[model samples]
Target: MKKKFILLSGLATSLLLSGCWDINEAQRMYYVDGLGIDYKDGQYEIYLQLINFTNVAKSEYPNPQTVPAEVGQAKGKTLEEALFKLFRSIDQKVFWGHMTFIIFSEEALKDKNALSIIDTVLRYRETRYQIWTYCTQDSIKDILLLTPILNKSLISSKLSTPLDTDDQETFVEPVNFRNLVIGLNEPNHEIGIPYVTINKNWETAEQQGQDTTFIGVGVLSKSGFKGLIKNDAARGMQWMHNRTHRGEITFKLDGDETDFLTVTLEKIKVDIEPLVKNNQVTFEVVVKLNATLNGLKTNVSEDEIRKKIIKEVKKEIRTTYKEALAKDIDIYRLSEHLYRKNVKVWKRLEKDGKIPLTPSSISKLEIDVNQVNSGRKTFTGTFND
Candidate 1:
């Protein structure tokens, strides 16, 4: 009887020990890494950047060989139709959950087309809100096909992780999809997303390569896509943007011809006050930043460096406003500033469709540079000399 009970228990354990019979191999699935959307002539085009799961994970592959990403394109009368048409051509099971980036073409922003595309993306159950969004005037296929340098995983590209680059370079701030939606919803507010382009400056012994970089930002208004502002003109954006972490500036002080100073700045602080007087509204902005001398070509005091940096900062902010004013763009969202601080004035000007700020609208500007330090090494001259 004891032997019979032992046999029955062994048989029951075998039933519960069955291995995973329903799991599918990752090698059999096509994982989309990035998406591209474009619209022109009343038609929609979709591009997909597909990655091999083996390349993305270390243990997934036995040999560990890597290949460049694959880009596929399809077109239809609508965004969904284009996506489905692309699906029809794919051979394996498609996975969308790992997608990290989406790019839109300039033509796609016309006639409220951006709205429908954004809505469709959010409606997809597998997609996430953290996806980075960008606009490109370059070829969608080219941007999607650009691979990581040194043959690294495709996930290493700035398209998938922008803040990685910003931590060191800190140009136009990279923003994700959720922040984008909030910018559009807020009344009279303008938001910016990175403008991606293919840079061909890198090459290896056997082959040349392309890298995606931001030359500026694509500004968006509530109505639709506003326009793009170049980086040099938007220099002040690094500070007024409220998201700047660290950046560098190089300049020559007054009365110093042969000497120039390169400073690395961090800990940016900005304050904007909406000043209302006699039914007219203007904004006063004050900015504070800490500096470290990276390169020095001539002798100068810490006090002089601080004052020169302040002057440069003030000039950059005014120049940004001046340039955007030429394009009829309130790049700094001064309209929204007024709306939040002085709603009565904003409503009055908005009712007349006159809230688009002027150059004089930035009534006062102040910049304070502080906490100077000698960087890794000094160049050409000594700070004491």
Candidate 2:
């Protein structure tokens, strides 16, 4: 009976000690939603965007106004040091498990130690591999300070959510931490990250709003910060890289500046073939597109419009390829493709150290456009009529 009494007493004590021992109250923790990294003057600057649950959870009706998140900054010689310095100013333990996105300043990427910063982030236990990554030429602090205009969620949501969520599709593909790491580890060490900028417009004296806009893509080579590809060039890279989904294209009809045609992309398929002969390499790119007419101001049939689109897509692809080659930016990832398909040739080239291949090495490029649906038209007028 004494042994039984002792066992019961010990069980009670253990239960009391184990219950919620490490549990922190919700009010005592800061949930970081976004992280921004910048480098200047041999120092690393860290920016943390913390979501305010209290403000986000408000139940008020009729235009409730409350800031959803707040930003904090700190600087040090290393990433860890910067983060620790940031923690010094906050009373609550910063939780990073909920982080949705990360932004790196262009200046940070220009630094030779940019990859080291990424390695540091991967080492953290709380950091996630799937977090979206972006690069911006603007101030990292300003990017983090952007507040959501029409949405109630945090401003960082714009960068975190998939680009296809909106009605209009994005040109550049989204890159995550895992993809960035993989690219950096590739033989060529080339990668492209989506670029973001602020769109500031003053509407009225009482109301001035600023929103975040994805401008284009920033390319990174082994040397770092190659350049930026925007608009048509970015779209062209997406096609060659087979990263395009659904996006709208606007072009002039019959080379007339006033007559415009806008088409919505339905599907795209790209085939890249790498051929090796006598220690020389050449690539052939074939692009197939399925699209529909969204709007037309030209007096041409659907067949004619299809031909125009095919030509335009081919032009875009060639222009982008040439530009990348001139700048020594391998956005098409031709070397990676060769390594995957023709291993022996790629290894031989790598052993030789610095393969002498140019953009002109792409000998052939063909584009085939198919109009799946022309849509119903209220007015039927043809140039032949």
Best lDDT among the predictions, by candidate number: 1
Evaluated at residue 138, the lDDT of candidate 2 is 90
> Can you list the residue pairs that collide in candidate 1?
none
Model 1: per-residue Cα lDDT over 6-70, one tens digit each: 99999999999868997767888898889999887788988999976767774223233556578
Candidate 1's C-alpha runs over 4 A off are 1-25, 59-65, 254-258, 351-354, 376-385
Model 2: lDDT of residue 236: 78
Tell me how candidate 1 scores on lDDT: 0.80
After superposition, the stretches of candidate 2 with alpha carbons farther than 4 Å from their true spots are: 1-17, 55-63, 164-167, 201-206, 351-355, 378-385
Evaluated against the true structure, the overall lDDT of model 2 is 0.76
